[model samples]
Structure formats: C-alpha cells, structure tokens
Target chain A: MFNKDNQLEKFKDAETIIGASIKVKGNFQGQGSIIIEGSLEGSLKTDANLFIGDRAKVTANIESKDAIVNGEVRGNIKSKNYLAIGGTAKIFGDIQYGEISVAKGAIINGQLMMLSEEHKRNDKLKPEEKAVATDK
Target chain B: MHVYIYDDYLNKSKYNKTINRIEIRLTDLGLNGKIIRLGGIKNIKGTIQNEIKLGAKTIVAVGNNQTINKIIGAVIDTDIYSDFQKKTILGIIPVGGDNSIAASFGIKNEEEACNILLARRVEKIDLGIVGQYYFLNQATIQSLGTILEIDDYSLEIIKRGEVSIINLLSDKNQSIKSNPHDGKLDIYIKTKRKDQTYLSAKKLLITNPNNKLLVDGVIEMATPIEVGISKDRVNVIVGKDRMFE
Candidate 1:
C-alpha cells in the first residue's frame, strides 16, 4: 500500500488527467506539471511542463516551459523552451516558443511565428518568464 | 511527535475552537500534539509549505477539494520532497469545497476521516500530475469542460450530482460531426436528423464514420491528431478497498 502521506511527492513526475466534467475559470499557476484532460476557460501559467490530452478542451491562454498537445486548444500558447502539436492537435491560436515541432496531421488555424533572434536573446536572458500574444 | 492541523475554517473563533477540541482529543489519546489552524483559502498553500519545511510530520487536513488542491499544489510547488519520510501521513476532514476526492476515497465523513487518522495506517493511492501539480480526480477537456463553467461553489454544495455521459452524446451539437480527410488531425463525426426518440437513440450509439475530431478541447477539421497517456506514471493513496491503475 502507498503511504497516504508523500503520495503527492511520489507522483512528482506523473501524467495527469483533467476529466471532461471539470471547468476551471481561475488563473491556474503551477510548477511541476499537469495534463489537461478536461476543459479550462482561464489562464494556465506553469513553469514546469504541460500535456494537453486528446480529450482536453482549453479556452484559456497557456504559458509553459514545455508542452505537448494531442488535444484541442483554442487560445494562445507560449512556451519558453519547447512545444509540440500531435497529429491529433487542433490548435486555434498562435504559438510562440524557442523550439516547436508539429506533427503532420495537426490542424492550426492561428498564425505561427518563430521567436525573433533578438526576442530569443531577450527571452533567455530575462530573469522571469514573458508572455506572448498575437493581437491581430 | 507533533501533530499539525490544517483546516480551512477562516473564522478565528471557530478555527480556534476546533483546534482546541482536536488538541483535547489528542491529549486524551496521550500523544504529543500542537494545533495549527490553516487560515483562509489563500493562506493554505503557504502554511502547508511552511509546516513541511519546518520538518513537521503528519498533516491533518480539515477541508474539502479546494483545500486539498491548494495543499497538494504547495507541497509540490515548494519542492519539499526531502520531508516525505517525516511528513508521512495525511489526515483529512471531509468539510467544505464539495469534498469530492474525500468522498470518492470513502473517507465517509469528517468523523470517519478523523478516526482513520487516529488509527494511522498508511495507504497508497493513484496521483495524477498535470505539468507539475498533483491531482487526485480525473481531468476532462471538452464536453465536461462546459459543465465546469457552471456554478462551482453551488454545485459543490450538493453532496452528490451526476452528469450523464449518455446525455452528452445524445446532444447533437456536442457529439461527433464528420470525419474530415486529413492525416494530421484525425476527425470523427456523429450527427443525425431529429427523428423518433427510439430511432435517434439507437443511432446515437453507432459511431459516425465521418466526424470532425475534437482534439483536446478544440475541433479538429483536419485528418489525425495525436494522443497518448503514461498509465504507469500515476501514484496515489487509498484505503484497502481501493483499486489502483
């Protein structure tokens, strides 16, 4: 049997599921990680990592160091380090990151812009994280 | 051995009263005890983090899902991994914030949770991680996401409420629509013209060969979208009757 205490710590590197019945409206900020298996209408700010699950529906903007999407994301997503959209991903917003890899079958309606050389320099050098948005 | 009490009772008087009662209970039981009342929701994370950092063992929580979520987030966020051996048990009182995770775990009620805590037998359960946070309940994205937008505090107030998975499928606007021809984003569509109840119901169960894919939470008009899960990664705590994946 697992210890009821330290259960959270044991899963320091576990995959998460945000089920379909959950809708969160607040700014969700976390560090270690999470997988959105449900719906989110607010902002997702995480410095650790994120996995947008296949069944997830996110209307909120996302900020992460790394992300993998096999789900549907309607808002903008900004990753400082890495980002990937699975073939099943249906992304409707802009994506800004240092490195991005999209699989062949992904559907993205939003614009895609690689980080500018100066922006990359500024991003890496900046002490705190920065937000990226496509206003147009 | 110090027993730390983490409760969400914001009212100072009530909070103090509850802690005093617990302290009396502990003293009667002949255990070294100290009652630390967790304040309002916002202060919860910081308090738990501080307690764990100070090498406090045995966290006795006194609230529901919202409180648990905050504590879990802080525990992971602060990266207090080194204190696991000392902070080895979680005692919960199923109060406030709907207590969904508590109910699901069969903690029964606040009294039962307290009893279990006093008994102090450790159990392991499944824990879900999203990015860095740890979650005990299942995560959803699309159809269920819509439901989450409804009233939270009110919905939580209900001891029990169930959403029909069947109802979600029967609703045409929410179900599969059409399978677009694209390899990148796999789409599956299921729709039917309104007909007699029996006929429409039967058709609903049948998969639509062509339906647009709702990837994650967005509609996938393209061919195939990717998806996967690491089933082996989740770890959590549960009673002996619990079944883990």
Candidate 2:
C-alpha cells in the first residue's frame, strides 16, 4: 500500500547517485535504483526506479520500472510502472508510461502516451508471440 | 587437490611462525594436496596448467588477494583448463597483505580458512572479466576524465580521480549492495573535487587511454577494457557467515 510519494521517497536510498557537478556519457544498465543530480548524456535502463534531481540535465533515453523527474531531459522516457514529472521539470521528448502524474508547473514539449491495455497484455506474453505479432 | 603458495610472503623470515601454523593446520585438517610455491608471475600459468594436467580438482591460493588474482589470470589464459575452469574450486588462506577477498568470505585468518576448507562448504561465485583477465574483487583506474561505456550509455568523468568496477562488494565504503553471484558489475567513480564526486553503474566499458588498471587491489594491466560478469566462474570455500548468504 505505497503511494507515489512513498515510492519516490524510497529512491532516496539509491545505490548510485550522480552528483550535481559531474557529467556522464555512457550506457548504464543495472538492477538497482539510481539518483541523478548531475548531467548525463546517454541511455539508461534499470530494473528499479530512477530519480532525477532538480539540478540534473539528462540527454538520454530512459527505461525503468518507475521514474520521478525533477530535472531537464532532452530524450525519450519510458517507465514500466509510473512516471512523475515534478514542478521544476522541463522535458522535451516523448513519454511512454503505464501511469503518470505531472506537477502544475512542469513543462513538456512532446507526446505523452499511457501504455494501451493491449500493449500491456502484449508485454506480458512470451517473446515468440510478441515477435509473431510484430511480423503481423 | 593442489595448493599454490605465493612464496613472496612465505619466504620472508618474519612470517616463519605464521607459515608453520598454516602448515600444521593444513596437515591436521587431513587435506592432502600437492603444495606448489609460485616462483614468479610468469610461471603462474604453467604451474596451474601442470597442476590441472595432474588431475587437480581443487586449487587453493595460500596468500592474499594478489595470489587469487594471479590464479584467476592463469586459469583464464590457459586453454587446457578452460573447459574445467568452472569445475575447479579455488581456496584462499589470506596470509598476505590485502586479504579482502578472504575477509569477504568470513575468513579473517589462516586458521579460520583451514576450518572452512575442512567444512567443505563451497559457493560458486561470479567473476568480473576485463578482456582476458578475470577478477574476483574489483578493478580500478586512478586517472579520470575518461568516457565509460555500458551497453548503449556512456559516462564521461569530468574530474581527476579513480573509477572502479566492483565485482564482489567488500567492507570498503560502497553504497550499492553488490553480490558477486549477481551477474552484474558495480561501477563507482570517485573524483578529486570533493562535492563533484559520486556516480555508479552496473557495468561499463573503459575506452580511455589510461594504461594502468588495478584488479582486486593487485594485478595491474593495460586498459581499453570491457567489464562484465562471468557467471558462476569460480567456486570457493566459504564460512556460514559468507557475504552472499
């Protein structure tokens, strides 16, 4: 019984934290949650949640279980579970999410799509069926 | 069984007492194995190959992290032992300077290590591979401002410091809870500028011009390295309070 606020709070104990002054350019994939307060330019995918701090500037495609963004992102974002755009957030890319919440002052300049039920159902199927559907 | 003793520590006159104690403990534990004193770094591969040819099922390293690192390098480079590498069990005694690997397995001293060997409890652990080398603990680079790549993402370090790829999470200050068996490498970047430091990734590729890479705090190698998890590559004797458990 955890709300979005509670879930976001859980990321405070992130295993990886990119500091405000650092700049990273690479592909990052992991099982643990990560918090970013710096600048990153690449792709990021994790089995856990991702927390982007207000001072952060990320120019990378992001895929994660959940995401809470309070920064500036210039790339696509796809969250499997939930996506929260904070008050200070400024995003300029398409967003694909299962569920999402946006703060009143947040700015987004691209498409936002809640994952379709058929897409969700397709996601649950095995790789072979998904491949067959793609062929069709 | 074969025991490869790193003679650098054992040959020292100061450690006669410790060496004697380890010898006595090994004998008392009823573990019969051919003990080979490693002569130099160059001879490591040949020694391991010879032992494996002589039907060695278990190879014990009777020194610190350096000794284990050498054995891992030898086992990985030698083709004769490749097929049987996973089957071969590696043991540690922790008699040298940095015994963090042994310490991670709940083995603080030589006596406890011998006892664990007698208990015969083995854990198949994961190894971090950097090109041809296999490391059990972690690999690090000091000079920063290098671009680290992991899959499709890249992390560019802005400052000068150390960037480490950790395999087995040790007692060292690590925010990430990394398990050696978890088919993932923990990447930690620490910079010289105090507030500017801090970054972690699961896996990364080192594409920098830095020449030196330290593995397990020992074994320095040239870079342009690819780091990843080699699943269940090594079997080691561990105590009941081992790290993974």
Candidate 1 residue-wise lDDT, B140-212, digit = tens? 2222112221212101011122222121111223322211111111112111221100100101111112333
RMSD in Å for model 2: 4.1
Q: What are the runs in model 2 whose C-alpha is more than 4 Å off? A: A1-5, A9-34, A42-48, A60-65, A75-81, A93-99, A108-136, B1-6, B39-48, B82-88, B192-204
Q: Identify the leading candidate in terms of lDDT.
A: 2
Docking band of candidate 1 = incorrect
What residue pairs are clashing in model 2?
A: A25-B154, A25-B155, A25-B156, A26-B153, A26-B154, A26-B155, A27-B153, A27-B154
Residue-wise C-alpha lDDT for candidate 2, range A1-136, written one tens digit per residue:
1265596677666777776656767776766788888898878778788988899999999998788999999999998777889999999999999889898999999999999877766765679999998898
The models' CA-based lDDT, in order, is: 0.49, 0.76
TM-score of chain B of each: 0.52, 0.82
Cα displacement (angstroms), candidate 1, residue B167, comes to: 23
Q: Over the stretch B1-245, how does candidate 2's per-residue lDDT look in tens digits?
A: 65545556677788788878988888888875787777544576787777777777778888888777777777664586565465577888888678888888878888888888888798888888777667788888874656776556566776677777877866745544567876767676766444333444445677667557777776777767777777787778887766666
List, for all models, the DockQ compared with the true complex: 0.02, 0.50
- TM-score of candidate 1 to 2 decimals: 0.38
